[model samples]
Target chain A: MRKLYTKKLSKKDQLKDLEARKETVQFLLNYSKALRVVKCRGFTFDAILN
Target chain B: MNNVEITDAVLVREYMQGNETALSKLINRHHHRIYSFIFSKVFDRDVAEDIFQDTFIKVINTLKRGKYNEEGKFLPWVMRIAHNLVIDHFRRNKRMPKFDNSGDFNIFSVLSDSDLNVETQIIKDQIENDVKELIKELPEDQLEVLTMRIYKDMSFKEISERTGVSINTALGRMRYALINLRKIIEKHKLVLTN
Candidate 1:
C-alpha cells in the first residue's frame, strides 16, 4: 500500500483496487510455495550426499 | 495417519528421512498463518511477500543443514525467523531511507553515506551526468526541489519561496526525490561509480 496512493484514493476506488491487489498477492503466495519445493529438493539431496 | 494427529516434529523427522511430501504438507499447513503474520507487519504486498519467501528459505536451509533443533515447536520457530527478517528489513530501510540498495537491502547500513566521501566522488564527471539523468525521472514537484537544492545550490527557504510551497513541502519533495532516484537505480541495476 503506497501511502501516497492510499491518500489519494476514494473509498470506492479503494474497494475496487482491493480485488486486484488480492489477485497479485495470491500469485506471490503460490509462487513462494512453489519455490520452496525446489529449494527443499535441492538442499535435501545435498544433505544426503554430505 | 490422520493429518490432524501428525505433529510438526513428526513431519520434520519424515522430511529428513526423504519424505518429500512431508515438507509440502508442513508448508501448506502453515502458509496462510505465516504469510498473514508477515503481511501484518509490512502493510505492502510486495514487501510482505518478499519477507515471507525469505522466512521460508531460511527455514528450509536450517532444516536441511541439520541446524534446526527446536523439536516440536515448528510454528514458533518459523515465526521467529519471519520476525528477525522483518526486523532486518526495517533496519536496512531505516538506515538508508533516502537511497536504499533495494537489491541487497544493505547500502548505507554497511557504510554510512558520509563514509562514501561524496565530496571526492563528485570529482567523477560521469557521476554528475548519471545523477542528472536519474533526477529527470523524478516527479515534477520532486524534481523541482531536488534540482534547486543540488544543481542550483539553493536553500530550502529559497526553494519554498520560488516554488510557492512551504519549506516542509520542499524538504519532503527533496527526500522523496532521492528515494525515488535510488529505486530507479536499483531497478536498472545501474552503477554510477566505479
Candidate 2:
C-alpha cells in the first residue's frame, strides 16, 4: 500500500498513472532480482566446486 | 515446485540441504524488494548491493546451521537482515554512504540533471528526497516516530512500546509528519502524485 498524495490529479487521471507507476515498480523489482542471481552465481561458483 | 509456488519455508529447507539452485531462486524472487528497501535507507546502490549480498550470505549460513525459524513471510525476514547489514555498514564506515556499482537503483546518485526518461522515477526520487529534508526539520520526537512508522514499517502500537509513548501520541506524530511533508511539497510546488 504505497500511499501517494495525488491531490493534483483527478480520480481518472490518478488511476491511469497509478497503473503505470505499478508497472514501473514491478519492472524495477524484476531487475533487482536478476541482479541478485548474477551476483550469487559469481560467488557461489567461486566458493564451491573450484 | 516452480519458483513462484515455492514458499520461503520450502526454500529454507532446500537451502539447508545445500541446494545451490534453490538459493539462487530465492534470491531471484526477492532481490529487488530487498534491494530497494536497503537503497532507501542507505541512498547508495553499491552499498545497498553489498549489503544485499551480505544479507543473503548470512541467511544461507544461518539456515545451514538450522537457525532461521520465523514462520511468516520470507521477504520481510530477509529485508530485516538487509536492514541490519546497512545499519552495521553505516556504523563501520562512519560516513554518509554513496553508491558504488552501476546498477538500476544507483542511477539515482549519478544523474547530472540530464538524460531523464521516466517522469515517474524522477518524481518519486524527488518526493523521497523532499520528504527526507522535511523530516530533518521536524522535532526529534516527531522525526523518530515518523521514521519508525514509515521507513521501518513498524506499527503505531509497536512504536509506542519502543518510544515509551501512548499509541495516540504515536498516531499524532505520524499525522504531523504527513502534514509537514505536505507543506514542504507545497512550498516547492511539486505535485505529490501522478
- Candidate 1 lDDT over A1-50, as tens digits, reads 54332245543443332211345445433533344323454554332221
lDDT of 2 by residue, B123-171 (tens): 8888787778767877788899989988999999999999998999999
Sliding window of 10 residues with minimal summed lDDT for model 2 chain A: A14-23
Model 1 RMSD, rounded to 1 decimal: 18.3
lDDT of 2: 0.67
Question: DockQ for model 1?
Answer: 0.03
Candidate 1 lDDT score relative to the true structure? 0.72
In Å, residue B32's CA in model 1 sits off its true spot by 0.9
Give the alpha carbon lDDT tens digit for every residue of B127-159 in model 1. Answer: 788888877888999999998898899999999
Candidate 2, residue B179: CA error in Å? 24
* lDDT string, candidate 2, A5-31, tens digits: 534544344223111123333443343
Please compute DockQ, using alpha carbons, for every candidate against the native two-chain complex. Answer: 0.03, 0.03
